[model samples]
Target: MTYALHQGDALRVLASLPDASVDAVITDPPYNSGGRTAKERTSKTARAKYTSADAQHELADFPGENKDQHAYGYWLSLLLSEAYRVTREGGALLVFTDWRQSATTGDALQAGGWLWRGILPWHKPQARPQKGRFTQNCEFIYWGSKGAIDGDRNPVYLPGLYSASQPSGKSRVHITQKPVGVMRELTKICIPGGTILDFCAGSGSTGVAALLEGRNFVGIEATAHYAAIAEQRLRETQDGLAREAETRTT
Candidate 1:
């Protein structure tokens, strides 16, 4: 029902938050992937890696995509460790990653003191087809818990596979914005009214979804451009909720 968005380094902001403060951490950090070779993956900017050459949108690029595989693993482990400290016991972690970084993400989750649970595939229907190979149309979400998950607390049966398309045209604010429909479903993992933290909250998709789902949100964005965009989206979501509440009350 409420949200707090911090514009700064995610690690630094997370450190300032109290331990056992949040109920879940659902984040989609940069994959640091796009090419098979190290040079291609490390050298290219986020816009160059994720966006096509002829893409119509003039969306701003994001950071944290330059790290090589080894560096990425270490950085992710540190972030997850910080997130684990912020989460209460039995709280959950759901992180978005591509096939190239799935193994590393799982390793980092365990390294961060979380119990590895399972992987959820997010199928993108609009993905372009490839020839002579399996079409890489799916992204993965690695989910786990701080400890043993007490299902009795928040007993909502979530699906294993999520299918959604990326936002396009005017609705797309971030280069890698997840669909609000998908995000709303993902937000249900947390208990009703519980707080969710998204460290890499580009354009506030996760925070907006969390608030609309009757949950509290705490977000951290590093880039000022995306932070301002995120703040605007979060405010609009809150205003819509407030209007809805007022309508029912009156």
Candidate 2:
């Protein structure tokens, strides 16, 4: 397994990638659903918006969480357009977003020239309940394919929904880190040994999962702090894989 982590603006970095270079684009970009008003969006930090008052961890806030709803749509479309160019025909894209931004994300996916497929929900089992309304426990994955999808190429039945909780305790490095187990299963969207791109790599859970699943990875992170953390995590994953291989051969 191999992986590359680039630290820069995702939109700019994506433009530099070669066309048809990756088999899948699996990313958890910032949902930007924190604040409704422009003033709130600009003023509130990511940690202030997303975290509860008594939240234990002190993870640093990431950028791009301040985009207003209208700006978010345009920004996402441009980023997705570059992503589409780098994905081969029949390749898939999976973007993570909350209910507030799901519809706009779908529109952006199509605007990027991808053939919209369907939604895949990720249900958090431990989500807090609201007495007056339904629990806001589910985040959605809007998936699409570059042109027509050829199931024959990566023939495998995958689940329609995923059940996983956010990373916790010492394992939680990023403010919005996804579970590695969920990412490992999601990486199956790509063919074995094929490369996957995650422009908003964060703490690199996506790349770590790809390497663990026998796939290659190309990750881009905007925050230097998270990029360094991602680099360390990727290196640790590679070292762990090498140890396992050596143990088997020994």
Candidate 3:
């Protein structure tokens, strides 16, 4: 199976891969923020409203809805179908979503026949606050398994309320850039030395985490610019790890 970056559409690239090809799936799909409405895409003018506050400017300009539950589900269904096809039985799928879409997305996964394992709340204490709304300081990761649980040996542990600080400065590189600590923690649950797949690999934080934890990674991105940035980040991570290994050996 292919184990490198493919500079193409995620859906098309995933479709080309064989069934049950990947060991685990960990991704951060679009929150549908840049889209105009749940049903329709954003116009050019509307897309221009992106501010420097976004982690990635191009991603902020992505034409999709942050609240299009139905349409988002449809899109996710295709990805999930492909993800399921490429994931082996007893494999894991870790999906990251904000409070706005977690429940709906989780329900969709259940309907798609994946076993709902549990939810891991990634508490970011330094998240931005809304003027009139409650401060959303956490993003929940819904974990799903391909088949039934194995036994007591594979008991799932609840990752206690982790209180990692979010990135303080604004970044146009990737809007929803997760902390390295969070991704690193998630990688520890899965078996070591297996391949990991991430489709919505914004700035490649997941890829960095995978490499640092001694696992090979394959990331897919739709935007050429973001994909290139992700590739660069992955390369940097690999290089950093190699350096660390050399230091230890010396």
Q: Encode model 3's per-residue lDDT on 120-216: one tens digit a residue.
A: 8888776679999988678788889889645453454647456677544553356557788878878765567767889878778888888888777
Clashing residue pairs found in predicted model 2: none
lDDT of 1 at 238: 96
Model 1 ranges with Cα > 4 A deviation:
none
Model 1 RMSD to the real structure?
Answer: 0.7
TM-score pick, better of 1 and 2: 1
Task: Please list the C-alpha lDDT of all candidates, in the order they appear.
Answer: 0.95, 0.94, 0.72
TM-score of each: 0.99, 0.97, 0.82
Q: Which model is ahead, 1 or 2, in terms of lDDT? A: 1
The model with the greatest TM-score is 1
TM-score of 2: 0.97
Task: Summarize candidate 1's per-residue lDDT along 116-179 as a digit string, tens digits.
Answer: 9999999999998988888889999999999999999999999999999899999998889999
Worst 10 residues of 1 by lDDT: 127-136
Model 3: lDDT to the true structure: 0.72
lDDT of 2 by residue, 1-250 (tens): 9999999999889988999999999999988887767788767888888888888988998988878888899999999999999999899999999998988999999999999999999999999999999998999999999988888889989999999999888999998899999999999999999999999999999999999999999999999999999999999999999999999999
